[model samples]
Target: MDNKKVIIAGAGHGGLVAAAHLSANGFDVTVIERFAQGTLGYDWTDMFEKDCFDFCGIELPKNANYVKVPESVFVSPNKKTKIKTEVLSPITNVNMDRSAIYDSLIGFALEKGVKFEYETKIISPIVENNRVTGIFVEKNGKKETRKADLIIDAAGAFSPVRSLLPSNLMIENEFDNTQVFETFRAFYERDMTVTPPDTDWNVYFFHLDKPGISWYECREEYCDVLIGRFNKFGEQDIKQVIDDFKNEHPELTDKIIRGGQFAFIPVRRAVGKMVADGYAAVGDSAAMTVALIGSGIANSMIAGKMLADVVIENNGKTDVKTLWKYNVRYFKEINADICSLDKLREMLCTLGTDNLNFLLNKGVVKGEDITAAIKEGGIKLGIKDLIEKATKGISDIPLLLKVMKTLNEGEKLSKIALSIPEEYDENKVKMWLSEYNC
Candidate 1:
């Protein structure tokens, strides 16, 4: 690997983490970044599982920002009922400032001898024999080709390179905007002058109810206001929502540090095929974000490292057969529950307000159930809890029937995900792909 060159298409968390791992493994790695040196990611606070600190190998620099917002309470549209989960274990759900994390990861990767090309745009991949050999990049005023033994696409969810690849090489699909969670969030001045929303962090559900949700967080410096919708809100104006909140707390919204950031995050499960002969995808580009809650910082780091390890373990071969193990390990070890939860997300999102009211307000779906669902791995329900849920289901037969029917179908997906083949058998892999909607 020391003699081999690797090109990562994005300098986001996934690319930076992969660069560090590969550099540590003695590979010559270079990151192609679209943004300039400093202005890379959006202004937002994200929470990752604490295990990422140990497993992802990212060091938290002194003065690193840690957000203190607690778990949010979900208020019903009618406002008659509110649902709150106890503070998730700090050990599992850890809040982090995204900007600080980017700085630390970039600094550490640079120190590890990974090269970065700032203000570079990836034009296209240079494919040879159906294999991604390198990329054509545009920097300054000219376009130049950078060749590498392998190309890793960490270029986020809307990755163009992934789109341009020949259909036969991989599953070529466009990121439909309908599947995106279009979020416009702001960090406003938090004025102690006006009383803020209770729970510090809370969501107002059923805001026109169309497969979307909104929430807010109060930080030391600002009140974070986030409003988002699914498919593309036809006439819904999130800006107006922010304005309403601002009117309520002008003292806090008056002085804005970072006004807002609009980001479209992928809310899908992992991609079916993550590799061609000489290419692999990680992070958002790979659709690695967790389902429903839309968290991927930790998953990307783990995916990046696992991809690098698979490449190394295959004697530095970047062929499809060798790289396929990256998908194996990711689905089996790192994101197995994510696959299951993808089904779960579909089910829960399909349920109308009525179903949720019964589940959340009536305690059919206990707060502990949510705590378990949002945990890093995913939900784990014991036999006792199952019986309890069954007993409770008798009170609401129709809603319970819907839930059970959905759960029964979803379990099939879980079983398929759990039984991923150890070795890549083209036929078996093809079958898995069909089940995974390849």
Candidate 2:
């Protein structure tokens, strides 16, 4: 393909990964970032799937600061019930230094001849003939139009381009006003005098509310404390909950090494359409963050690679039909099961404390299901998977009803998501999306 000018409208992990891939593939790539130079990324590193980096062909520097999480322990609100989950694996789940990963990707993209426009925020897409021709951006208080063959918005969920798109835009739907889970994560100094817990990561479920969980992870000298609401679970005073959790864990010192972000994580499933004429989206822009875990690092990186490949294979054509392949491959092939977890989220958030305790006590919600949801994006269960629990819980009609409803909805959503069209046929895409949107 002849050299194509590609504009990446964010310098997040997904955008950086896309820049690296496209630049390496002989595209004239330029990445616009809202943050100042050298001030990229969050203070804390996000855990990700190992295969994502490999899939995107972006290698980390030898000195990349990071760790491997072996497992995570889950506890009930009262600490009476506990479940241990295999969260880390050789196949996926690698935790690394957030800044190191960004810097490394920037270095790689730079080496591949990608231009970096720091502190430049995109104002809107330059649309003409029903196609995105470029972008209108502001840099140092000056606005300019930068033309490109394709524009990929890797901006977070609150992307200007995505936001400004006309209501009639094919790729636009339900992204706005979606419930976002706001969180505060801190990697604080650990009192070396106190021995850390046996498990590296401890997760407490049904804490403060029926729908939220609190997490703590030890990274040698420091511990990572993540307190957030579970979307659709319950609305509770987050500040009070965090304070309560802190009170319980005295080992977490005030000396924070990283992270004080009031980050808003998108809890919604992937948007129905992620591509438009001459434009596409990745990462949180496309709602690529996983359903339950709220981790978009791996999904976003994979989205970048998939988008680059589609653009290259289409011979640099930037129309909706050609770019639609990126959505199909990433959604259907990589994460259809994961998308189905949204339905599971609905049931999870609505279940009362009594139901949650019963489910946990009866082994109705196993560690395997959680692992599968994180690893494969959906839990595949047969009659055998629940027959034992059903028999054991025969006396609890309310609990049984809730379980059946959750499972039925999960199955239906999974089927619908898997059958998403391979092409951006307006009618088909709209029809398929109505299942979830309705």
Candidate 3:
């Protein structure tokens, strides 16, 4: 049989991994990216699981520049209380520059004979009879069509290809403010003259009593600062937050070192439908980030490998039914945890500063609990643990009740996520989607 041709719509981390794996498995793979070569990733660093490279079967980049990410200090909105989390032994997380990660994945794909079309813009998917068959693209000021046996959308959260798909496909085409995190990240020169805080990393919850998070990490030469909100915010809001940080911490200097830009991240569970006839989505296009942290690198890469496995197992069949296996495997192995965590994230957004301060001040929510929830990607407090927390926070019965309600709701969501239809029956999948999303 002739080799199946795969077109990766974006050079997304997971899509690159999938391209490599598919190429290695005797499929022809091509990646089309809007950014030129050597400028494929963001101009900043990100944190992800350290073991993802091994899991994706990609070698770590030579002289990989990274540092073990220390456990973060969660500061109450009032900034009077800080809860330091316990550090995990064996160092589960690492902060690596985004460019280095892209270099590694791109190199791996190249070695596997995957072709790349740099500086190519993907306009939309080419559909016929409700099945995607190729993509419409523009390169060097010229528009053209690229045909492929299958298309993998590794595009970012706002991929036009995903947005423009035919409505009958059942795939979600848009993300509301509640499902997205608007973020501004910057790295500023550190003022050595000023004394740095004792903690290397501090995350401020509901910064300035706003429904958002802001954090600053003190590095040797620079301070990495990120301000994020669930609702839409503008430059003025960003400036206000930066000014607040500068006033609070003299170590954060005015000189910008790098990464002064705004971006959006999907902070919800994976999309209800991620596959259609002859097409599938991975990475941010699938909303595959950890809702609490907006970290998708590890999960996206893992999903890439899972997708490749499914495609190879099915002998390169790209129909919706054949592609549904990838959805089932991903939901069972990964999304259940994300779905559970999203509930907690939603609660944090609405949980006022007073209640949050109370939880921290009263030790109802401890550092270890925070660490566990992040490490495990979900909240899993047992009845005994809940009872202990309730007793400790007996004064705030209403807040405790709210926490309990969130936990219960999270459990229900997880069950629904795990119960994704094993096979692609249109009506059954539609019903499941309604229940799961509701």
lDDT of 2 by residue, 50-168 (tens): 77777877675678766766577777766667788786674566778888888877888898889988888788888887888889999889999899988889888788887777665
- Best of the candidates, lDDT: 3
Pairwise lDDT winner, candidates 2 and 3: 3
Write model 1 residue lDDT over 50-137, tens digit each, in one string: 5775687766556867666486676665545667866455556677777888888888788889999889899888888888888988
For residues 1-438, write the lDDT of model 3, one tens digit per residue: 168899999999889999999999999899999988898778898888778889998877767767657657898888878888764333777778898998889989999999999999999999998999999999989999999889999998999889899888999999878788899899999889998765357888889887778898888778888988887788788778878888878888777889998898898899989999989999999999988678899999999999998999988888999999999999999998777678888888778889888877777777877776666655667668768877763677778888888877888998999999999999999999998887
C-alpha TM-score for every candidate: 0.89, 0.91, 0.94
Ranking by lDDT: 3, 2, 1
Ranking by TM-score: 3, 2, 1
| Model 3 residue 246 CA deviation in Å | 3.1
- What TM-score does model 2 achieve against the real structure? 0.91
Best candidate per TM-score, number? 3
RMSD of each: 3.0, 2.9, 2.0
Summing lDDT over every window of 10 consecutive residues in candidate 2, give the lowest-scoring window.
Answer: 230-239
Candidate 2's C-alpha runs over 4 A off are 173-179, 230-243, 246-250, 384-387, 436-438
